[model samples]
Target: MTDSNVSFLGRISLAVGTFFSILGDGEFAARVQRLRSGAPVTQAPVAAPAPTPAPQPAAPALKQASPDAALQLLGLLQRDARFIDFVEEDVAGYSDADIGAAARVVHGGCRTVLREHFTIRPVREEAEGSRVTLPEGFDATAVRLTGNVVGKAPFTGSLSHRGWRVDDVRLPKLAASHDASVIAAAEVEL
Candidate 1:
């Protein structure tokens, strides 16, 4: 709190106390970094409200989702991947080898459907397992914090997964009369 010179022991004590503080408080960590780099230290330990953040648009609003798109997606999945069939099937008696083979086919079809209909990409550019730092005000929805997510942002950790983001969707337009509820029509062979 004071600019008065601290003794060697006192500096160590400060380091130990502030190390915990830095972990819990991003602003404190930033100030510590500034001091370490010979920048002027503010007397107040409490971080002043950042004015720029005051105008930060509120966390993106959760839009009122239409079920039509969801149903359409399901229909596409059923058509391409037989996803519904795979999920609904009673595979309890199937051997692991058989299930694996079936899964391989399903996986390929599902992948194909996703690739065709959606322009998908990883949320982060960095490779998984790479060290990354999430700056303050990072979109919470985009970068889901996992495993011991404590304290303020400016989080530094290994990238567990480069999470997917749907850049674009290209679902086919359906007729107004078409019933989206029927994901897959029952077959009636003549």
Candidate 2:
């Protein structure tokens, strides 16, 4: 081989060595070393073995609750508080005072319904805006941490809200004839 050809080949070999070294390919590095030293490159007769497949875990079955129960709850709220009507109403045209007046009535009715049907209490005993420490292994579902959340807790932060939790539910049983899907019945005067 010419001097220029040998030099070019050496440079290519050095480049391949560097690439294989970076990839941590020890076997490839050995082969490259042998090639650079003008040693004969021989392949073994045996073919490469096929990769083994990884074992897959069986998926757990999911439990689904009846939508009728949720519909029944919504129907009861509408009946007792007119909750659906107030929420569905457009308030863009109404003045702030008018809206506030309507909201007061809605709020009173809704509060009455909630008091009668469901027992609710705050999730955290601490007053809102009070500094509190959430110890390690805290319930993630009950308290959500916001802003620069890093490392393991006890996280110290001001309580933005004392979150509500339903301690007990006492919804009345629906009659067999009653349709839960009907949130509110339409009234017509003759």
The per-prediction tally of clashing pairs is: 0, 0
lDDT of 2 at 157: 89
CA deviation > 4 Å runs, candidate 2: 1-63
Candidate 1 lDDT for residue 176 = 87
Q: Residue-wise lDDT of candidate 1 within 1-190, one digit each (tens)?
A: 3559776557768889987788756677778888998888876456566433322335776889888889998888888888888877768799999999989988988999899999999999998899999888988778866544656778899998899999999999899899988888999999
Candidate closest to the true structure, highest lDDT = 1
CA lDDT of 41 in candidate 1?
Answer: 83
Candidate 2, TM-score vs. the true structure? Answer: 0.63
Model 1 TM-score (2 dp): 0.66
